[model samples]
Target: MQVRFWGTRGSLPVAPKAGTIADKVADALVAANGRSFADKAAALAFVEDDLDFATGRSYGGATSCVEVDMGEGPFIVCDLGSGVRELGLDTLRRCAQEGRPKEWHIFLSHLHWDHIMGFPFFVPAFMDGAKIIIHAGHPDAEQALRRQQEEISFPVPFDWLKADIEFRTLETGREYEIGEVTVSVILQHHSHDSYGYRFRDRDGKVAIYSTDSEHKIDQMHDENDFAQFFGHADLVVCDTMYSLADSVSMKEDWGHSSNIVAVDLCHEAKARRLALFHHEPTYSDADIQRMHEETIRYEELTRDTDALEVLCAYDGLCVEL
Candidate 1:
């Protein structure tokens, strides 16, 4: 199984600035500090230096979408945030290159705007004979899709989309077969009822995706329940939207997890690796790096038995198992 992140930001979309010197300086300061360039004053000075940015352009600032290719039949996508627009276009390009009909499956955790906003922009839905299966926890995934295509909100209605679309509502603890992969869905604690997915390949490789989940200290203390929910996965992608300090202050119960909590969950679940997702919009690349370093240090001090590998998710980042 191979997974690719199309967007990693949380809350809203963050677009790349066009030749903005301030943005360039912020990127350089972040690189130099090896952390997020949080100090606005310092970041501005770096921008004034006119640093070159061939490497910076590659890290796109799209929002919360992921694509997983299970190497069996069709492509599997997670969420449909603004990043899906690019994923859709890329799918079209790949289909054209390979000379095959488009076939894709989209699994949605919830129907939040940021997670489904890019559905209308997905180019493949306009093509005939394109088979797209939408697996989600929402009561009416089809209704939500139609809402986005309303005349008041969009220029085109849902009926205009030519692709054949199917919706399947998944239940918690039940496993569904999609080609050679078995997917297990679990209901998670989020502002809205969200579903976390576990994918087990025929070869026994496992990947669990549990984004938009909030991990409270009390909840973490209960090892039996949480471990049963996330245990023994090869790769677990989790929500790490706030630092412990930030979470304690105003972000408490904000429907997000801290990096420290995510690390502990990985250790508890005995997951081989933890890919942190749903980054706060305010977190720059440097900030994410700092969080990763802190989590690693904490894990070492705690002597986490799993020795889990921790990584921050980035747009276009791919991992193969």
Candidate 2:
């Protein structure tokens, strides 16, 4: 199983800085990982002129989105933030190049605007005979998508979308199957009710995608629930939208967890790998590096049990399990 981050910034998209060391590292990492570094570099270059490592300004844009390819018959995507626009275009190119019809399954955690704003811009919706299934926790799943189709907001209507689309409203705790993947949904604590999903392939490779959730004061009180929900997960993508200090101060009850809290959850759940996700919009790449270092330090401090390997998530980051 493989997971690829199309966009990682929470709440908004962040722009690239000119000739920054971090940008170079990011480009190098993409090349090392078999992605198109030249194209990425070109894109960054077109956006900036001066190439300073320090004193460079970091830019910001849209929210969270990710794609998970199980190497099976169908592809699975999480959330539908502005990142989905790129995901859709890429999917179209891949399908045309392979001469196959597009087949995709999208899992939505909730109907928040930041999570669904890119749906209309998604290129696949414009293709004829494309197959897309949307699975979400909203009781009014279709309504949520339809709300974005109003003439006041968009020139095109949902009915005008050319793809063959299906919407499935899921209930909490129900397990469902798509091709070789089995997915189970769990309720999470958020501003409104949200969902955390667990996907297990036939080979027992497990992945849990849980974001937009807040940990209660009795942090470990529901540990057993998560243990059962995410037991033995190979990868866990969790919400870590705040620092310990920030979370303890004003961000508490903001429906998000701090890095430490997410790491603790990974430990309690016995997850093999934990990917910190849903970055705060205000956090720069350097800020993310500091958070990553702190998370690593904490992971090492609690490494006696070897519970989980902690890492941070960035756009275009990919993980194989």
Error of 1 at 12 (Å): 0.6
The per-prediction tally of clashing pairs is 4, 8
Tens digits of per-residue lDDT for model 2 on 24-49? 66654554455343686764663354
RMSD of candidate 1 to the truth, in angstroms, is 6.1
Model 1 residue 290 CA deviation (Å) reads 1.6
Q: Which residues of candidate 1, in runs, are more than 4 Å off?
A: 17-59, 99-101
For each candidate, the alpha-carbon lDDT, in order, equals 0.80, 0.80
Candidate topping TM-score: 1
Per-residue alpha-carbon lDDT of candidate 1 for residues 1-321, written as tens digits (9 for 90 to 100):
988899888889876556554765566656676644579776555554544333243335777898877644677888988899999998787777866458888999888788888899999899998999999988777888899889999999999999998898888768898887888898777876888888889889888888887878656775456566678888888888899887777988887888888878878788888888888887666577777778888878765465888777888889997
Best by lDDT: 1
lDDT for residue 300 in candidate 1, whole number 0-100: 81
- Candidate 1 TM-score over all chains jointly: 0.86
Model 1, C-alpha of 253: deviation from truth (Å)? 1.7
| Candidate 1, residue 101: how far the Cα is off, in Å | 4.6
Candidate 2 stretches greater than 4 Å from native:
16-62
- List the lowest-lDDT window of 10 residues for candidate 1: 50-59
Model 2: residue 149 alpha-carbon error in angstroms: 2.5
